[model samples]
Target chain A: MAAAAHEPEVIRDKAVMRAWSRCRRAEGKAVALVPTMGFLHDGHLSLVSAAVAAAAGPVAVVVSIYVNPSQFAPTEDLATYPSDFAGDLRKLAATGAVAAVFCPPDLYVRGRAGHPAAGASGGAVSCLEDAGGHAHETWIRVEQLEKGLCGSSRPVFFRGVATVVSKLFNIVEPDIAVFGKKDYQQWRVICRMVRDLDFAIEIVGTEIVREADGLAMSSRNVHLSCEEREKALSISRSLMNARTAVLNGNNHGQQLKDEIVQTLKEAGGQVDYVEFQSLTFSLD
Target chain B: MAAAAHEPEVIRDKAVMRAWSRCRRAEGKAVALVPTMGFLHDGHLSLVSAAVAAAAGPVAVVVSIYVNPSQFAPTEDLATYPSDFAGDLRKLAATGAVAAVFCPPDLYVRGRAGHPAAGASGGAVSCLEDAGGHAHETWIRVEQLEKGLCGSSRPVFFRGVATVVSKLFNIVEPDIAVFGKKDYQQWRVICRMVRDLDFAIEIVGTEIVREADGLAMSSRNVHLSCEEREKALSISRSLMNARTAVLNGNNHGQQLKDEIVQTLKEAGGQVDYVEFQSLTFSLD
Candidate 1:
C-alpha cells in the first residue's frame, strides 16, 4: 500500500470510536493499534509497520497521542514534555495509516467526564490533581518486570502505562498492538499484562530504531543538549560491547551486568540500572 | 421488549465473539454484562434482571460462570466451593439472556514459558508466577476503602475481586456491567476501580435481593446451616434499623455504625464490620 501524504483527521469521542469499529466489522477487516505518547519518532513508526504487516485487511492504526500525567513522577518532566500534532499527523499520513488520529486529551485522560477547567492551555501545564477526593488510584502491578531498571527510578511509571494502555486497548479493540524494544522492560511488562488479563490482542515487540550514530530515538532525546546527545550513544554502544563480551564465553550474568555498567560510567552517563536474565520469557 | 425463555448459544473462542460482536454491532444493540461466580442465587438473578432492563435492543448478558480461585482466601473456601454449570445454564436461560458463559480453566491465567503444562486450565490447578521465577503471593491494595469491614478480615479478597473484575470487563466489553449490593464493599471497590481507571462502561449497583425473612441471598448461604441462616438475617435487620435511624435526622456516623455492630453482636453471628461514609459514594 502506498503511504498517504496529508494529515489524517483526529477523533475524540467514544461514540465515534464505536461507530468506526462497527464500520470495520462490516468490512470484515481486523483492526490494529500502535499506541504512543505522540512525539512520534522512527521507533514508533517501526511498531506501526509491524502492526500493519501483521493485520489481515485495511488496518485502523489508532495512535493515542496523550501524555498521561499519572505516569510521571513528581520531579519528572511531565510539564516540559514536547507534543506536535501537525508533525505527528504528517508522519502517520506518510505511513498510509487508515482512519483518524485519536488526539483527545480530555477523553484519554479523564474519560467520559470532561477535562477539569484548570484554565491552562496552549503550553506545558501540570496535570496533577490533589490526592484528596480523587477516587481511583488503584494500579496494575506487573510483579518482577517493574522492580528493576527504569521502574526503580520512576516508581508509578508502569502503573500509569498499564492503565492507559488498558484504556486504549478497550477503546481501539485492536487485534494486534506494537511496542518498541528500546523500552525493553516496559514491553515485557505489557506482554505479561496481556497474557495475565487474557486480552486477545497479539503483542509484537519491534527492535529499537536508532540514529545513524546509534543513540536510541526518543522524544526525550530532545531534552538532551548536543553534548548529552553524544553521551547517550554510549548507552547502546555499551550494550553492544557487553553483548560481545558475553558471546566470547563470559557467561556470568553478574559479571556481564557489571561490565556494561562500568562501560556506561566511563562514557560520562549516569547509570540507571544494568541487569541480565534468561531471555526464555514467553507469552503462553 | 418481551423476555423470552430459551437457551443462549455458548461461545468460547475469539472468532465467535468477533462474529457475535459484529452481528450485534450491525443490529446497533447495547450489551450489558453480569459477572458472577455462578452458584446461581436470587441476588445474582437480580443482577441479571437489572442488566436486562438497562440494556437496549438485543441485550447480551454474559454470565461468567467460573469459581475464580484467585479471589478466594486460602483460609476461606476455595477447594470445596459449589459449581453447577448445567443448572446455572438453565437459570440463565430463564432470564432470556443472550449470554455467553466464559468457563475456561487457566485460559485467563498467564503461564510460565517453556512450561506448556503450567496453568493449562482456568480452574484451581494453576500457580501464580511473578517475574522472579518464584510464586506470586501479593494482593491488590485499595488504600483506604479496604481498611474497614471485610478488607481488614479478608486481606486478599478485594485484590482478587478487582483483578478478576478487570479481566471480565475486558472479555465482555459490556456497555453496562451489573453487580449485586449484597457484597456492598466489593461493589464499592469495583465502582472505585471503574471511576479511577476511566472505564467507559457503566457500573450498575443492583439492590440486595433478599429471602422472605430479609436474609441476603448468596452462593455461600448454601454452606450455612439452618441455625447459621437464622443468624445471618440479623445482619440485614441491623442494617435496615440503622438506615431507619439515619433517616430520622441522625447525622452521627459513628453512633449509627456502633448500633449496627451491637445488634449483630447480640445475635449469634460474628460482626465483620459496619461503616458510614458520605453520600457521595455511588456506582458512577
Candidate 2:
C-alpha cells in the first residue's frame, strides 16, 4: 500500500519489467496484472481494483498500457485508436493500487539480435510494421474459439490479443491477471490460451463498468457524436430489459435476443449480433 | 556433479516441474532444459552433455520426455511413435548430467478443469483427442519459418514443436535450453519464437551426433531391414561428400544438390531434399 500512494514506476524495457516482477516474487509478494490499451476509463481501473481485491494478501499490481497492433486489421482503427499516456498515468496514480506501469513503445520490434532468417514476410503478420524495419511473425491462435463473434469481423484480432497477452504474461510473470468482461470473447480466448498452453497464471474476469446512464465504458466512446452516444444507450437498456425478462421466467434465448435486436434497430443502430452464450462461451 | 552420480528424479506433473524450477531459481541456481520425445539415443545424451557444457555455472538440467501430440497430422505416427520410458530413464541416468526428467502423461488434457465451450471442433486440431473429453485448442505457429523443408512434407510438425516447446519453456522456466541441430528448422523456429514472443531464455543448438558406422541415429532406424539400413547409409555419405565438395570450391548450390540426389537414387534410396540453408535458415 505504501508503494501505491505515489505514481507507479514506468517501465519501458521488457527486461526491467521482468526483473521487477522477479524481485517482488522473491520477496514473497504476489504480483497481479491488469492489461489495458491506454486511455484508461473506469472500466480499466475497475480491473486494477479487482486485481488488488482478488489477491490473497499483499500484492504488486502491474498495469500495462499498450494498444497492441497485431489485434487490429489493416483497415481497422490502428492509427486512430485512442491514447493518453499522461492521463493514463494520472488515472493509475489516482487509484493508489498500481505498483508499476509497463508502457513499452513496441513489444513486436525485433530486439538487438536481428532475425534475417525470418523469411520473406507474409501471412497474419502483426499489423504494425516496425519503423526500425522487420515484422514480428510468431503468432498464437486459439483455433476454434477464435472463429466466431468479434473474430468473424476482425479476423486477425484474437491472434493479436492472444500473442500480445502471452508476451505480457511471460514478461510480467504475474500470479494472476485481471481482464474486463466487456470484451467477452477476448477474455474467453485468453482463458483458453492459458489453459491449453499450460501457462501457470490465474485469469480473473471483472464486471463491465458503465456510466450512470448505462452506456458501457470504452476509450473509443470519445469518437462518437452526441446523437450516436444516446443511440448506443439502447443496447444497454435492452440488455437490462432482456435480463429482467429472463429472470422473470421468460428465459427463451432467441425470443430475448430478438427483443434486444429490435430495440437497437428502433433506436437507429445497425445490429451486428446479439448472442447469448453459456458460461463456457458456447452460443446457447 | 553430485546429481550426475544418481538417476534424475522423474517429474510427471506440470505444476511439480514448475515448482522444482522455481525453487532452484530462488536458491540462485540456473536451470537448463533439453526437450525430447522419450526414445533416448546417444544423439540425445550428447545434447545433455552440451547442455552441461553450455552452462555458465553449475546448472540444473531438466530433460522433458513428452511426445507432443499437437504437432502431428492424423496420418502421421502419433500412435506408432516409439517410446521406452524405463530405458530412457536408464540412458539419462547413465549420463549423470540430468537433475530431473519431466515425463508428463499428457500436457493437452483439460487439467482438473473442464472446457465445454471449446465450440464444435474442426480445423487443425491436435492429433490426439483427450480421453478425458475436451480438446486442446490453443496452438502456436512461427508462420513463415514453419514453411518449406520438413514443414512442406509434414505440415503440422513445426506447429506441434513450437507449441509444445512453448509449454515446456513456460513449465520449466529454463535459463537456457539445448536443442539438437539434427532438428535444424525446429531449433531456428524456437529461436525465432523466443525473439518474436520475448521469451527470456537462451537457446543453444548442439551438433548432431551420429553413429560410428556413419548412420545418423534415429529411433525409426529400428524399423529398417539390414539391407535397407545399408542403403540408407548413402544419404549421410552423400551429405559428407557434398560438404567436402563445398569445402573444395564446388559450392554451386544446384550442382552440389544434384550430386547428392543422384547418389541417393543410385543407392536405392528416395531423396527428399538436400538443402543448403544459411545460419538464419534462409535456403540458399
TM-scores for candidates 1 onward, in order = 0.84, 0.91
Candidate 2 structure lDDT? 0.83
Query: Top model by TM-score, which number?
Result: 2
Q: Pick the candidate with the highest lDDT.
A: 2
Docking class of 2: medium
Show model 1 residue runs off by greater than 4 Å: A1-6, A107-135, A250-255, A277-284, B1-5, B10-28, B110-144, B250-253, B277-284
Worst 10 residues of 2 chain B by lDDT: B113-122
Top candidate by DockQ: 2
Candidate 2: tens digits of C-alpha lDDT, residues B1-284: 46445689989999999999998888788899999988989988988988898888878899999987767776877789889999999998888789899998888755333443342122444465332345577778887788788977776788888989998998999999989888899989999999888888989998877889899988778778999999999988998998887777665778778888998999987766678887224324
Task: State in Å the error of residue A237, model 2.
Answer: 0.8
Candidate 1 predicts chain B with a TM-score of 0.80
- Over B56-158, each residue of candidate 1 has an lDDT whose tens digit, in order, gives 6667777776676666654677778887888888887877764666655543443455443322111222223311132332223444465567877776567
